[model samples]
Target chain A: MQLAVLILEDERPVREALARDLGHFGGHVRIEVAEDVPDAWAVIDELDRDGDRLALVLADHRLPGTSGVDFLVLLLDDPRTVHTRKVLVTGQADQQDTIRAVNDAGLDRYIPKPWNPDELRSVVRDQLTDHVIEHRLDPLPHLQALDAARVMPLLRTRGDR
Target chain B: MPTDVHHPRSTLPRPTHLQLAGLVVGLIAFLVPLLVDIPGLEPAGQRMLAIFLLAIVLWVTEAVPLVATAMLVILLEVLMISDQALVALPEDVLAASDYFAALADPVIVLFLGGFLIADGAAKFDLDRNLAAVMLRPFAGNARRSVLGLMLITAMLSMFVSNTATTATMFAVVIPILAVLPAGPARTGLALAIPVAANVGGIGTPVGSPPNAIALGALEARGEGVSFLGWMLLAVPLMVVVLLFAWWLLTRRYIAPDTPMALDLSSSFDRSPAAIVFYVVAGATVLLWLTEPLHGISSSTVGFVPVVALLATQVMGGDDIKALQWPVLWLVAGGIALGAGIGATGLDTWLLGLVAWEALPLTLLVLLLVAVGLGLSTVISNSATANLLVPLSLSLATGLPIDATAIGVIVALACALAMALPISTPPNAVAYATGEVDTRAMATNGLLVGGFGAVLLATVLPRVWDRLGLL
Candidate 1:
């Protein structure tokens, strides 16, 4: 099945560059772009209703509107968007505090910018393989209504639920 | 996960209007001294009350112009005493010289030079560049991150205003702290920047208010402190305190050193405007020394640095428009208070009341320091200096020590009051940042203040004496 992806980023250049790269995903990857949290939320809900496979989120941390982490904080809170494998994209590599948020939110990966294009492509390829394998496993008999359940372990933090 | 709100909910209802908050703050600013000055409470308690009033006013009411509120301190000064001036100048009207004196204070020139340097540095985006390179080496480790921030803040504050320094460094480090692997480094940064901001501000007269007041008092007494001489004192004091602050704040460790990816260009990395800063500083130092370079008296030499700064901007085309007018006014108001203390013979009267013949000069310096530190706890540093500097000048003139050199210590001591949250803006700013607690700052601040006091009373005086200041 064809997969659709949402790119939530504040910078025009970064969003556009990521969209162009996603065209190489080959199974007719449909790309939607949202500049900030509100628009991204609207897009996420629309995609969920359409039953489009929202395979990934490529988000930049220092967005012009809502902060990337704050957006993720709200995104993970919603059951609809929880199925989407989230990845944090940042230009500021010195931010070590993102790891905890990434762990708490069940983030798949962090792409530090001034990115090596080859490295981004390889990571994207790896993520796409994992999505394909999981969906293929659920193509038949034995699957719970377990959309976000597999990723829940990453999001389950100690001390509080 | 629930998003956290920073302020804890309390039963006390929020004040209905900004005006109410302003009026309450204003009234407290007025009433505080009398309430605390009465008896049982220490002067530290009294100063804390004034700072609490100012801090609440600053935090609570956005409507009140801080400058206007700061000017209201004149009302406090007016009420702090009722001794009639033998010849009172009309209220709301200044004698011509009182107004002009603001123009000639070397503190203004020093501030002008600092602004030009920092402005020029900003043009180069020095803070951003420094953050980019500095944080890269500390990438994942929390402790190294805190250290990186302290060093950058201290260096930048020597040129920029301390408020600007804290704001700039925080902007840079917050991003770094957010991306760091979850650990204590983030918390340490939240605490360190505020304190470092306070300590770093001590590096220059223009960085904080008390330095400006102290510098003004020194210049007024004809023992104008030199730029080089001021640095000689500020460098050791600031650098030492910053390290102690780092130790006090964080116990985390660094990961191995990572190679830095420097995207910076070396071409004019240090702004050419530094040439202007150096020229202004050089002339100030020359005048402070050799003592007779200008055609008039060394007393008039404070103007030399001011002239040099103006000439450099005009002839050299450096922008000098960033001078903070309110700060100049505040300094002038402070200088006026110090001068009035001298002019009123209050300094002489206060000095005579003390048994000067009974104590040695070194002991006298120690006592004056104790009073300066104590006075600063209840009043603003500028107010503390205004109260004590003139008295020190009067006492020194009659005694065998350099009164002007002691005045420099008085200035440094005013800035050095690390014991309270409200004593200096840096301390207050750091406390407000929500990272460092008051106890951490107080414990470290006292150690910092003690070492600073010793440096001034012992080391600075001996050196100034050797330099013929005594």
Candidate 2:
């Protein structure tokens, strides 16, 4: 099964940019974009139907309704995305919202607006690697998108049959 | 915070087309021998033949997991041809416990010790630390660095499982791999780990499952090779094949002038617990090598570590629980299959079908080696050894060759089948790095395996004889 990365954003230009920057990972992972909370849930449902894991959620803090912090908090209650890595990719999240995201939503990383494309990709890679290692998933299928050196310990346990 | 929706889905794997086909084909193969009367085979022999045929299909297609197929072989023998057979055997029947005993065979115990020690090495970070320390001397140039990497990998593989060795070595080299320009040099470095690991597996009985399978079968037939004896018989070939592969890979892919630097930083675990583990692991190896010096069997010496590690709390129940039981069971299944073949007169029936003595010994040996090397190239190496070692040993009974030589040769041949990513776990790991493609792996693997095959089939036996090892 492929690992799914959901991009929760409201702006068309930003959504497209995020998806394009992650284009290389498309072949290795399932990348989905949503305009709001409802659309994001639809993406989760589609992923669930296809038996793909919701591995990471890159969400903008400011959305039309049910803000990204709220959505991140909701993920903890949903068994499907409970283990999903949460990231706030926004410039507008204040101290209060960011605090809640860290304490309650279990945010993994915060990528500020005007982020470097290389750093964005590296953060995604690191987050994805963390997800796989935490879940003890077989990293061979997603080795290209992963930090290869980080997954070697898992590989060592698979003895010769 | 709001409570969210819970969608708990069950994801059970569906059988592939090959598995579906295997089940159907295996049923037909299993029944044919039981229903159709052979010209000279006995009723019990036919029953054993049915199990063997089913095992071949299931193992090849992997209709079930490899360990499942192994466990199935043991259960089938108990219910079909053992003393508790569903249809009472008209001839002498092996006791059911005889089949079950494969799980705890002396060879299995030996592997159990080896595995615990290997696991402990990883737990204490001893493997990576040791590699770092050993690789310091060979770090100047690309060629020398690769030689150091390969030699260290092979040395670890001689004691650790081959797959584990490759993984450990890859963990050490991946940073270095990233620094080197991604091209033939990267491919060469990636390929070196598996080649060394696969060849090194032949160095010791506990190094790989196929070795345990061969040793188990040979031990049952009253022709057991001491641990040191096994080293003497196989290590020379292991060293030769490794050097040949190093030369081939360097000449073809690695340029001597390429920029390379190996990371040698390491911090070994010096905890009291780590000290206890080192002592136990070291004493175990010393005991295995000095088997001739002392009267204790390798398996008995193997058990000492299992007891000492636990008694001293160096390794506990959790450590034992983490041991590779599936591999142990798979080897056991092969032992049971081998035992059934001999006990039910199936070997006699098989020997009569082939005029093996008529073929020149060298030609026959080459054929056996070729078949072992070829079959295992696609299937699991342990399964290939499981199916071939017993039959070849039985065939040797009627020929003018040492059974030990035949058994050891077949096992080593199985180790040499690494021409594809699917051939062995170590190869699969190298391929997953995406640094080495199939063509490079196949070309290098073929040259290495072929070179090893020729030496194993033609030269190793004579070497054994000349050294009075056989």
Best by lDDT: 2
TM-score of 1: 0.53
**After aligning candidate 1 to the native by TM-score, how far in Å is the CA of B350 from where it should be?**
2.0
Give per-residue CA lDDT, model 1, range B352-390, as digits (tens).
666897898788888888888766754566556655665
Model 2: how far is B335 from its true place, Å?
Answer: 0.5
Per-prediction DockQ comes to: 0.03, 0.65
Structural RMSD, model 1: 15.9
Worst 10 residues of 1 chain A by lDDT: A152-161
Q: On a 0 to 1 TM-score scale, where does candidate 2 land against the true structure?
A: 0.97
What Cα-based lDDT does every candidate model obtain? 0.58, 0.93
Query: TM-score of chain B, candidate 1?
Result: 0.65
How closely does chain A match the true chain A in each prediction, as TM-score? Answer: 0.73, 0.99
